[model samples]
Target: MPTDIAFYTNPMSRGQIARWMLEEVGQPYDMTILDYDGTMKAADYLAINPMGKVPAIVHKGKVVTEAAAICAYLADAFPDAGLAPPVDQRADYYRWLFFAAGPVEAAVSNKSLGLTVPEGRERSMGYGSYDQTVTTLEKAVSGGQWICGDQFTAADVYVGSQVDWGLTFGTIDSRPAFEAYAARLRERPAYKRQKELDGALIAQMQKSS
Candidate 1:
């Protein structure tokens, strides 16, 4: 039997986020692993994602790109998975999801590259300042067991990835709240399964290289 979902990604990239989301959705998807310097930039994969990036998904013939978008898309596509909050009650869910994808992502990436906002230019940046963004993020996660409270929706998967990866890579501050939330996410079976699958793929790629 063929599945309608096709996942294009490299284990070493942010594709891990989508993989985790896929695992959480508990749906079968055929995955295509692309190499950064080669096939990813080739014309074939380019059609799926003009940017030639990993972590693009083709679901039922429609294309979805970007890790955060993919996470949210999967949640809605598979409502039975219960990964999204009720439609009318999704304010917080959408808030933190885009927050991580936008501000949090920008702040961390800029800091990693040693790029600062420069004096008086904080207002020019979407994240304002790295400190401000992380501080706000800390409060967001500290609000409840999940970003939207009690419900561990797709928001957790996206926001949690930012916190989890930030802690592991020293990209984001390891505040107590962040550490606690990440620890909880790590215990989820879906998170563990995603790590295991990606870990094995990473090892194989290393050995073959």
Candidate 2:
């Protein structure tokens, strides 16, 4: 039997990340778009995700929350899509993937809020500092290639999404490395196809509103 994949999402939110991961995995998923005004907070949705957040997934009777976790799960479940590395590269894969969700996210959120830690507390902070995170990411992409060296894995999908979103919203500086990395991700046919479909839907919603 094929996996029953159900995606709970709000198109305007982090749900977009899960949508992109679905596209990358090339899986047929049922989408339930939730509204913030008590729709997602409803008992049914809350049962699937106690946190009442979108971008949760139910596959084969198992529920998965968090955008990064969903992305990683889909990649592993759909190995035919080749979005994940083999067991040999699993360590690096998990490292960068969580790094994206953890440190990268922390740095970006802090920077956006104009929150800074004391100089001595840098080591205590997971991301060290916003500048350090950006510099490290720049070096990671400096070779004009994907994060996992030559191969583009699920790590790219997660981290690349952050890089692309950050650059698009002007939340992150547009360094040469970031620009090139984002360009490489944008060139993916899967990414383009998903973006085009979502863009049209967003436009229609805007027109209706």
Candidate 3:
């Protein structure tokens, strides 16, 4: 029997990354849409994630929070999707995947909040500076057709989503390399399908509200 997967997320958050990864995994998952100020903070949801985050998942009775973690988990859980490299060949995968979640997330969020680390405090911050983080990501994704070089693994799903959303929201600079890489990821069928589904869900929610 297929493992039971329950995806708890909102349509407007980083949950889209997990949804796209789920599509790539080719697994049937039941989605429970949670509101930002409503069900997301309820006791039942808080049990899965104390932080009351929007993108969390329950798979086979195990809960996974954070968008990158959910994507990584789905890739490993459905190895048939080929969304992951073998354990011994996961150096690039782990590096960029976690880098996107850490530095990329920090840089974008901090910049959007009009917060910047002073030059003297660059060493204290994990992302150094937004420019440094963006340039490094540009080089990383520009290395080849994909983040892992020649494979469209879960790394692309996580990292590419960050780049794409950053560019859209003016959080990250629109570097040529980032634009190109994001383009490649957007052309995937799974990404397109995930966008369509989430777009519809958002429209429905808007209409009801």
Could you give candidate 1's per-residue lDDT for residues 1-209 as a string of tens digits?
67999999999999999999999999999999999999999998999999999899999999999999999999999999999999899999999999999999999999999999999999999999999999999999999899988989999999999999999999998799999999999999999999999999999999999
lDDT value, candidate 2, whole model:
0.85
> Candidate 1 local accuracy as lDDT?
0.96
Clashing residue pairs in candidate 2 (N, C-alpha, C atoms within 3 angstroms): none
TM per prediction: 0.99, 0.93, 0.97
Ranking by lDDT: 1, 3, 2
* Cα deviation of 22, candidate 1, in Å: 0.3
Candidate 3: 10-residue stretch with minimal lDDT: 1-10
Position 15, candidate 1: lDDT: 99
RMSD (CA, angstroms), candidate 3: 1.4
As for lDDT, the candidate ahead, 1 or 2, is 1
Candidate 2: tens digits of C-alpha lDDT, residues 1-209:
34489888877888878888898888788878788887899999899999998889999899999989988898889989988878887766787788889988999999899899897999999999899888877776675487677888888888888999999998778998898899999999878877887787778867987
lDDT of 3 by residue, 1-209 (tens): 45499998899998899899999998889899999888999999999999998798899899999999998998888898999988999998999999999998999899999998987999999999998998888877988898777888999999999999988888889888888888888899999999999999999989999
